[model samples]
Target: MTTLDNGTNSTPAPTLPAKPAVSMFAIGTAIGAILLTIITAISVGFSLGEIISNFGRKNSVVEGLLNPDWGQIWSRRSRSAFIETLQLAVLGTATGATVALPLALWSTTFGNPNRALRTLVRSFNNVIRSIPDLLWALLFVTAVGIGALSGLLALFFFSIAVTTKLTSDTLDGIDMGPIEAANASGASLTQMLRSAVVPQILPSYTSFVLYNFELNLRASAVLGLVGAGGIGARIEFFRGRGDWEKLWGLVVMFFLVVFIVERISVTLRRRLI
Candidate 1:
């Protein structure tokens, strides 16, 4: 309130800052994205009507999912397959994660001082990471005979990519004081990393390894479909025979195993972190 010369009180009008204008670039980008999506959908012959019609039909897959043969889990063959899958996951994670630490270190600036070598390693990591686990399974199956060996190899590579990528990220944020001190003390590169770097990142790295194991366990089932040997092979067998009930049952069992293992992994990781 303000007092006027005439001794009358007066109030000033409240004011607000003006809203910022939306950029044309953002609007254009949104419009372009919408247009691209519509074009891609049309190009792919996407049809909502066809989808609805198909869903309305008596689909055996859906029926199988609805009424799965839970008894499949009790079969001796299923038990064997489950064991194979577990073995694959364990072996893959153990081997891959073991090597991943070195690969991760070599890719970093602190770990690998040579810029060219670091770039090469980074490129290699990127290429491997780009390939999905299924593709890796396919490649190994082609190179090696289709069996548990192929699956093991695929999981090994997949685990390395996952663990190395995670460990590298963790390495990036570590305290550099110990590293500088190690360098000033004339420590060797290996000694410096072991003393300064390894201690700091061990917990996070272990957590990543455990996480990688969980992923490997889940991926093992899919790897078997390509004849890499695991529960997926059994799943493929049931699928080939049109035994959707049995397939669904195996799927359910796999899910349960994965869920339990993931819970255990999460608990361990939480403690480590």
Candidate 2:
């Protein structure tokens, strides 16, 4: 407010800040998400009545899960299958993730200057990732005659998809300073990537590889259902004979192993980051 002495009146002059603008895009996105959730819920038959009606009914699956044998681990076959699963996960992650590092690097503009090459690499990665792990297992099983080799092949491509996608994303956010420095120092593309880029994303890349291993471990169990190898085959055997107790017992034991591995991997990943 300003006082006008001559007229004995008060006059006020002020400026008000404008309100913040809202984005239509954000509003549309929220609305779309809510609608999608509702549609999905309806399509999946989500209902409290359905859940209540199905609860506590006696069934083979429930009974088996409840009364697990808990001694399947003592069987020689079970032990061998567990070891094979471990081997498949380890070998698959190692080989696939190793290749993924280079493939991921090549997908980026900084690491690979050629736009054509980058597009090709990304396209290949996308194609590999589009195939589900089980489908890959089935395909390999058909091609390779249902063995550990087939399982390994499935896990390998799956690992490539997981690790490369993660590593490539990390590459996008790396410190451009070192990249620029390397370029100024007349470093070759390979040298610049190795010295500047790889070091920046190494910890993250390794953590992703460990995470991929955990996933591979779980998938390896299922791959055996398609005869790709691992304890899944043993599980299928028990399942075929309607030995619910043994099947559930085997599943429980296998998950326990996976849980332990995940714990270790998670710990290591934490340290890495």
TM-score of each: 0.93, 0.86
RMSD of 1: 4.2
The candidate scoring highest on TM-score is: 1
Top-lDDT structure, candidate number: 1
Kindly provide the TM-score of model 1 when superposed on the true structure, using C-alpha atoms.
0.93
Residues 1-273, model 2: lDDT tens digits: 122342354434443555668799999999999999999999998998877777756779889999999999779999999899999999999999999999999999998889999899999999999999999999998988879999999999999999999999999888999999999999999899999999999999999999999999999999999999899999999999999999999999889889998999999999999
CA error at residue 259 for candidate 2, angstroms: 1.1
RMSD of each: 4.2, 5.1
Segments of candidate 1 deviating more than 4 angstroms: 1-11
Clashing pairs for predicted structure model 2, backbone only: none
Per-residue C-alpha lDDT of model 1 across residues 1-273, encoded as one tens digit per residue: 123432453546444545679899999999999999999999999999999999999988999999999889789999998999999999999999999999999998999999999999999999989999999999999999899999999999999999999999999999999999999999999999999999999999999999999999999989988989999999999999989999999899789989999999999999998
